[model samples]
Target: MSVQAPRWRAMRVSDLPAASAVAARVHPGYPEDDAVMAERLRLCPEGCLALAGPGDLPFGYAVGHPWRSGSVPDLDTLVGALPVPAGAWCIHDVALLPEARGHGAAGEVVGLMLGEAARRGLPEAVLVAVGDAAGFWQRHGFRPVPIAAPAGYGAGATVMVRSLAP
Candidate 1:
């Protein structure tokens, strides 16, 4: 059976469980830990978005948080190593279940998140991509920052950024 296109919208508190489940399916490591996800949701509820189809079951989710000074020191180190400005909203995580995979749901989710950032007057959005997903984010206009992964997040995770127009 074919999966229907997911409807993208701002995530609500009730969406947490489904969102977390999709995240587990997609991110499976590092940030997928329960505590981390809960903390992220608690910190920036508005930055989170969910994608659901006709029946309302979540297919994917994207969450981000304000990149306040020293918010995530490891991220700070990597961004600091770059020649670009050190401040940008961090996209904490984004994930889509296998059934939702090739339907452009990811782009819609990210677009909504970046749209929110732009509306807030932020100039850019950043993320740490794992696995083979770096290319996916790259396709969405995120360019890799020339810095190695910081402590605790592990290697091979590329940090990327995409400018959001003011």
Candidate 2:
């Protein structure tokens, strides 16, 4: 059977359940805590986007916000370690449902996020990637920063950055 390309758009309050469901399916082992996800859904509604197939069933999603150094310890520390420009975007998380893997959904999501960052006049974007996804982010122009440990992602995560047109 052939899978259809999912329709992607900015997420809304109504999309919370569907987005959460997709997130759960995508990151089963590291399921986002409900409270944190709820806050993200509430505060940065436009920062969240969803990819859905027929019937609007979510197949993937990407969530991010203006990288506020004060809000994240590791990110703040990482920022201190680098000589980045004044303003940069930070991507908190991006995930695709298992069924949607290998279909370039993640790239689409990243593209959208980067486009948004560009639209906001940000010059660069950063993210902490987990698992074997380091190579994936690399393909999107993200380069790893030499750090002892991933700041916001914890443990062995790798921190990556991509420059966007200012």
Candidate 3:
């Protein structure tokens, strides 16, 4: 039997359960309500994606939305709405199961998110790098900015930014 590798695709409402499972498994220290993710998808479907394996089951998910820069949303809380005339792309979260790691899926989704942001004419991308994820974000052209990350992001969370300008 041939095994199929996971691939990135548009996230669907049905995938929320799996996405939440992946989040719980990958980031126990940082928990987010499934409704928060659902709101993001509803608010900006273009910025929501899932890494699907066989049977189209999601093993990882990425959620982003339009928002102001230099600000980090409180973890697990719903934004209620995305900002109009949004100034930047806020990469809310990206979670991958251990089995889904080392396949470049995360990086690929990041690139895709950045592309979406650029398509929307956003000038930059921002995210809170939790735990040891700062290095990973740094490798993706996101530099740790001087902004104060929320304490709800857990210890060692760093606010990172990457300019999407050419």
Highest TM-score among the candidates is held by which one? 3
Model 2 — which ten-residue stretch has the worst lDDT?
Answer: 75-84
lDDT of each: 0.70, 0.69, 0.91
Identify the runs in model 1 with alpha carbons over 4 angstroms from their true place: 1-4, 68-86
lDDT of 1 by residue, 27-57 (tens): 6665444555556666667877778776887
Best-to-worst order by lDDT is 3, 1, 2
Checking candidate 1 for backbone clashes, the offending pairs are none
Give the 10-residue window scoring lowest on summed lDDT in candidate 3.
68-77
Where does model 3 exceed 4 Å of error?
none
Q: Name the candidate, 1 or 3, with the larger lDDT value.
A: 3
In candidate 2, what are the lDDT values of residues 65-131, reduced to their tens digit? Answer: 6664322224322232322442666787787777777777887788888887887777788877777
Which candidate number maximizes lDDT?
3
**Error in Å for residue 138 of model 1:** 1.5
lDDT of 3 by residue, 53-97 (tens): 988899899999999877868898888888888889999999988
What TM-score would each prediction reach against the true structure? 0.79, 0.79, 0.97
